[model samples]
Target: MEPDRDSFTSLEPGGDNAIAVTLGILGDEWNLWILRHAVEGAKRYGDWMREGAISNSVLSARLGALTDKGLFDRVQYAHRPDRYEYVLTRRGADIWTVLLTMWAWEQTWAPPATPPLPRMRHIGCGEFFSPATTCGECGAGVEAHDVVAELGPSGAWPRSVPASITRRRSAGAKQPSQVIPHTMELIGDRWSAAILGALFLGARRFGEFSERTSAPPTMVADRLARFVRLGAIDTEPNPDRPDWVSYRLTPKGVAFFPVVVFMITWGQRWFRAPEGPALIFTHRGTGHEFRPRLACDRCGEELTASAVSIEPVAD
Candidate 1:
């Protein structure tokens, strides 16, 4: 079914503008998990339960919320009592790139939790390429050290001081600050990242997450609960199965895209698997890897951290 774009993307203004707009729709942990499943084929409640292992009450709430938001079409698959299956609408499918970016980020910076992640064979070139992002405009490779940021008219920082930034750029430490960002403290653990990445890659069932992440069931359940509480994910009831539920992403949850893409480009620039890059993602038609470039919307010059300045909005 065609999804109403307005339903999912209607933005609200508040603190930090875009981030705030994204946060209103975003929930913590399990929301993205559910959407990941929907993309992969977990249409019925039982399919979700068996896969995500979410509680009954929580699942019901999430399903209703997602349907209301128009991310999923609650299509009636059965007639006896009008059984329904939660299917992904166009807006929902758009989240796949966010998830895909995470998967690539995980493979590159998140460390080797398991032996070679599922290989991504580029259909055009028939070689493994890690998923990557390029500038939507100029198509230059984006890197963390190269970009500068400042508030747009709609954005305001809470403080009026110069932003001080510090980072350790090493990928070798088990708990290296470079590979793991503060944002990932909750979901950064390999297991949670793997689970989220799996969902984005279409592994919905709990068993599938386990297999994909090579984690035990207990670990999967633990991370799922953590994600749900953090408001990064949500759940819903699956109608066709009657006994199961579904999981889906909130808009706020989908807002994690920029972070994922940033990390992916960072990984691409810095860390590489000992054997080599595990996978590569290329354009379907062009077969060229994503080369992200960042330039000013107006002047169109390449962005550089040294050349940029940021100041808090005066209160």
Candidate 2:
């Protein structure tokens, strides 16, 4: 169904929209890589430089921005040369779940290639495991279908779309060795991320996706096609109209729920609208507001940065 044109709104920067604010921060490829490296113990300026192969000026700018966003604490480590390192703050460390979920998605969906992402071993269980998103209150596993979403007090789409500063950079830049290319393709682009978010929000038709994302129809068509090729989304016959089809998440797409949930949780904590979070999710099974926690599939204990180690993918 085509949504009413007047019903949708665009988000402007610094608005009372948590998703917009969060997207503006983490939507960049470099930023995601930087945060990923930070989680992996890349603290020194040269550390991320070597790991990401990012140029100095861009690295400096990104570091500064991250510091400003309260994600990193810039501490001087040397006196004579004024050397400093970027350390993740509590809020920044919370991004572990986001990166872990992305890793899990890539492990399940990314085409195998050289130098794949390292395997994560849960130290508590002494076994490698993928992250499972679970409810904090009820301890039940969560998936996209298990929740009900409603617009919060400040849930209305904003007045203008937030600018995507990373698209051109990501398009022109070379792929980094320690990067998640598939995840980047899905989320490195703001429009794609918005479309994914829209799908999770119950947008099923072409027009609905376009309206919900505020993206051009042509762009929406292109992304939907790309997702279909990626096996993340599939098309089904629309019973309401035989000529029309609805787009729905395949298991692969549904598996991406953790990534979305983590991002939303991070955004809610770091950014806020006047009314509250832009979107509110409630677990239908628990009948309570859903708070996502990433736990190890092996031990069923909550995963933490200090409790896990990364190792080469076993042959």
Instruction: Find the candidate with the highest TM-score and give its number.
Output: 2
Which sections of candidate 2 miss by over 4 Å? Answer: 1-16, 159-161, 168-172
User: In candidate 2, what are the lDDT values of residues 78-182, reduced to their tens digit?
Assistant: 998688999888878878888888878888888874677878999999999998888998989888889887767666654213456465453666655666777
TM-score of each: 0.47, 0.89
Q: What is candidate 2's TM-score against the reference?
A: 0.89
Pairs clashing within candidate 2? 10-158, 10-160, 11-160
Assess candidate 1 and give its lDDT.
0.48
lDDT of 1 by residue, 221-313 (tens): 888777677565687776656576555554435444455444333332332223223223343344455445434333444444223332212
Give candidate 1 regions above 4 Å deviation: 1-3, 6-8, 12-16, 24-27, 111-119, 157-315
